[model samples]
Target: MRTIMVKVKPNASEAKIISENGNELVVAVAAPAENNKNPLMRVFEL
Candidate 1:
């Protein structure tokens, strides 16, 4: 398994990987930051 740093932007207009710097990533998701939903999963589904 591999681990990386992810910065999440919830409630975005769309889901996407905004930027990646080495092991760090900035991800945006349309899902709100609530209800225990995994924003990363939403990004992957797109």
Candidate 2:
């Protein structure tokens, strides 16, 4: 599925991905080996 929207909040200790209508997608953040959480997620979005 293609992503309609994405948001990253490293400072707030959270990362969220919502649909076109404010519905959040289910995803999990793992350890540091992912080369920073947001970047991994961002790439996954692509």
Candidate 1 — worst ten consecutive residues by lDDT sum? 37-46
Model 2 lDDT tens row, 1-46: 4443333433434444334433335444334434555443432343
Tens digits of per-residue lDDT for model 1, 1-46: 2234344456667767777766556565465668436545322211
Cα lDDT, model 1, residue 28: 55
Superposed on all Cα atoms, model 2 deviates from the true structure by an RMSD in Å of: 6.2
Best by TM-score: 1
TM-score of 2: 0.21
Q: Where is model 2 poorest over a 10-residue stretch in terms of lDDT?
A: 3-12
Query: Which pairs clash in model 2?
Result: none
Model 2 CA lDDT for position 4 = 37
**CA displacement after TM-score superposition, residue 20 of candidate 2 (Å):** 5.2
Per-residue error (Å), model 1, residue 11:
5.7
